[model samples]
Target: MTVILNQSFTGISIGAVLLLIALGLTLTFGQMGVINMAHGEFIMAGAYTTYVLQKSISSAGISLLVALPLAFLVAGAMGALLEWLLIRRLYTRPLDTLLVTWGVSLMLQQLARDVFGAPNVQTHAPDLLTGNMSVAGVTLANNRLFILGLALLCALTLTLILRLTPLGRRIRAVVQNRDLAEVSGIATERVDRTTFFIGSGLAGVAGVALTLVGPIGPTMGTNYIVDAFLVVVVGGVAQLKGSVITAFALGVLQSVLEYSTTVSVAKVIVLVAIVAFLQWRPQGLYTLRTRSLV
Candidate 1:
């Protein structure tokens, strides 16, 4: 029983990270209809940013916290610049967007390799996050708990912004009907820029949280991108609720599979399941409203 609870707890923690990573991807791909292959690399950039803050700065604690926003800013700036330079030209062209973003991803990965080298670096969990607690004899890592809560909070905040705020409403409008939104005098360009910011910023924050749990490498995002995409795809493109449900389902399912079989086999099984689901629901599970958003 204890072991089962521990495993479930760990799976939930992983699900949270997937939620963050996929939520961003969901917006870019599902809502914005842009396949940002560089999305994963943005996460790598965030992890590296966290490393620099925690290792090189004088106050690791404060510095680490500061790195969170800095990571978001840096990634968002890069995302914005990318959108301005390349993505803007390729918008509405799905295949072209993929190719261009693929190039960008490769470039960023190589750049990270050049600057940070091939070796992986570990970021320390702060003292506040280093401890663990027991739940019915199931010891759970504190940092994992913190990450899970942080992820949930971020998800909720993002949902609220999209559901309540003017900017979010406009974004949703543009997402549903680009021509109509533009005709209505919505600043699609600014919204595009801001969307990139939010997407990249989410990656940045995910990077920081990830750094606390694993080794940071220039290409670390590669380890996560596929699964994150799967979560986004299965969750349905723009539906936050769908992303949350699918991410957690996949996470826990993957964990359960791992327990029952080898890790490699489990992943293959999970991938197959997702592929089958996509084949059945190519439009995704939670379709965003095309009309009546206003």
Candidate 2:
């Protein structure tokens, strides 16, 4: 029972990271109709940013705190720049976007290797997050708990933006109907840029959270990219609530399966299950009822 409980908590921690990644992916795809294959590189960029900040700052804790906003700014600026320089031209051609972004991904990977070396590097977790807390014979890592909280906080902030802000209204307007949104005096182009910025920023946060779990390498983002996409797909495109629920569901299921079987086998089983589920419900867990773009 204790083991099960521990695994459940661990699963939730993993789910939080998945949710963060998926939120970014879903928003970008849903808003722009662009398949950003290089999204994973943005995650890598954020992790590297955290590493650099940690090295430059005297206090690890302050660096960690500073990294969040700095990572957002760094990744968000890169995302916006990519959108302007490359992605903007490929919006009407998703296949081209895929190919272009994949190439971009490779370039970013090589850039990281060239700049940071090909070896894996990790920033130390803040002292406050280095130890574990035990309660009732169950132990929880401080870092994981902090990540879980961070994820929830991020989700809440996003929810508020989408629900309460005028910019969010413009975003939803564009998502629902680009032409109508433009005709209604909303700057669809600006909304698209903002969506990309926020989405990429969230991916950066996920990368920060990921460092708590394992080593940071040039390709660390690749490790979770597939799972992140699965979370987005299983939840439903453009559906944040669906992403959150599916992330937790997939995380817990994967954790339990890994506990029972080998990691490879567990992954295969999970993929098969997702495939079957998709076959049954091709639209996924939820769908946005938006007017068809003519």
Candidate 3:
């Protein structure tokens, strides 16, 4: 039982990272209706950004606090750029979007390899974020706790933006009916760009959060992209709340199973289960209101 508690906490930590990644992917897929294979590249971009920030702020030289949002901006800009150049063209053809985005992913990966090398890059935890905490006989890493808090905060902030802001109304309008939104004088083109920015930025923030736990590298995002897609798909696109629940549930499920078995086997079981669940529902755990695009 003690072992289970410890493992569960660890799993929650992992889930937090996945939540961040999946949330972004879900929004982009649901809103833009584009399947971007290169979404992971922004994550790598965020990782590199964190690495640079670490170099600057080491020993009172940098600010991890500031890096959080900066990393998002860095990744968001990359995402927006990709949308402007490659993604926009492929919007009408999702299959082609996949092809173009995949090529972009390759180019981004190779570019990182050229600049950062093939070896994994390391990021140091901010002094304030380094430590450990024990609760209910379970020891939890402070860094993980910090990340979890940050993840929840990001989700809440986004929820508020989507629910309360004028921009949010426009975003929802566009997602529901692009023609209708434009008819009402809503510049869906701008909304699309902002959506790309938010989605990419979230993934980048996830990359930064991930560096707190493990290795960072050019191909690192590849490992996460598939899982992110899984969470988005399982939770149902356009439903941020559903994404959170599914991500954490999957995370805890995978962790408990891994503790009892092999990680690979745990993953296989989880994937199969997700596939079965989707087969039954097809729409996901949550469905969006009537929308022409979805």
Candidate 4:
């Protein structure tokens, strides 16, 4: 029972990380219908932002707190800039966006390599997050708990923004029917830019949380990009509820499988399961209802 509980907690923690990474993609790739291969670079930018702040700031905790918002701005600005410069021109051409973003991702990776070098970097967790606590014989790492709470908080905040805010209403309107939304006097283009900013900003926040659990490097974003996409796709594009449920489900499944088999095997099993599930329901766990004629 103790072992089971521990593995479950571990799985939940992993799910939290996945949720953070995929939440942004849910908006960009899922809602906007753009295959943004460079999304991971935004995450890298955030992680690096945390790294830079830690170096300059005297307090690790303070730097981390500052990194949360600053990283969002940094990454969000990059996303907004990318959308303005290139993505705006290629919205209807998803393949072009994919190829273009892939190239951009490579460029960003090289830039990071040049600036930070090829070696991976590690950040020191604040004293508050470096310890562990036991609850009912299940040991919980403080950093992981922090990550879990952060992920939930982000998800909740995003939910409220989408469901209640004026900006979110415009976003939803544009998403449901772009032409109609424009006809209704909504600034669809501006909405697109703002949406991209928020989506990419979430990726930045994910990066900051990740530094607590893993190493940071130029290629680190690549390691999780596929998985993040998987979570979004499996959950259903533009379906926030689906993403939340799918992230935790896959996380727990992967954790349990890894316990019984090898990490590689566990991943393969999870992939196979996802593939089978998709074959049965290709629309994913949920489907977006849109008013667009096309």
Best candidate per TM-score, number?
A: 4
Ranking by TM-score: 4, 2, 3, 1
Please, what are the lDDT tens digits per residue for candidate 2 over residues 1-294? Answer: 999998888788889888888888888887877878778989998899889998899688998888898888888888888888898888788768978988999999999999999999978888899999998778999998898898889888987898899988898878777888999999888888999999999888877777777888889888888898888788887557888899999988889889999789989999999999899777678877755553
Candidate 2 lowest-lDDT run of ten? 285-294
User: Model 2: residues >4 Å from true position, as ranges?
Assistant: 290-294
- For each candidate, the alpha-carbon lDDT, in order, equals 0.85, 0.86, 0.86, 0.91
lDDT tens per residue, model 1, 44-69: 98889998887778675787789988
lDDT of 4 by residue, 102-206 (tens): 899999999999999999898999999999999988999999999999999999998899999999999878866778899999999999999899999998999
Model 4: colliding residue pairs: none
User: lDDT: which candidate is best?
Assistant: 4
Candidate 3 residues 1-294, lDDT tens each? 889899889789888988989878887888877877888888888888888887887752255666779989999998999889877777778778877899999999999999989999787787667778878889989889988998899999988999999988888888777888999999888899999999999988988887888888989888988888888888987568989998898889999999989999999999899989988878788877673454
Clashing pairs in 3: 57-61, 57-62
List the lowest-lDDT window of 10 residues for candidate 1.
285-294
TM-score versus the correct structure, for each prediction: 0.94, 0.96, 0.95, 0.97
Candidate 4 weakest lDDT stretch, 10 residues: 285-294
Cα-lDDT of candidate 3: 0.86
Candidate 4 segments exceeding 4 Å error: 290-294
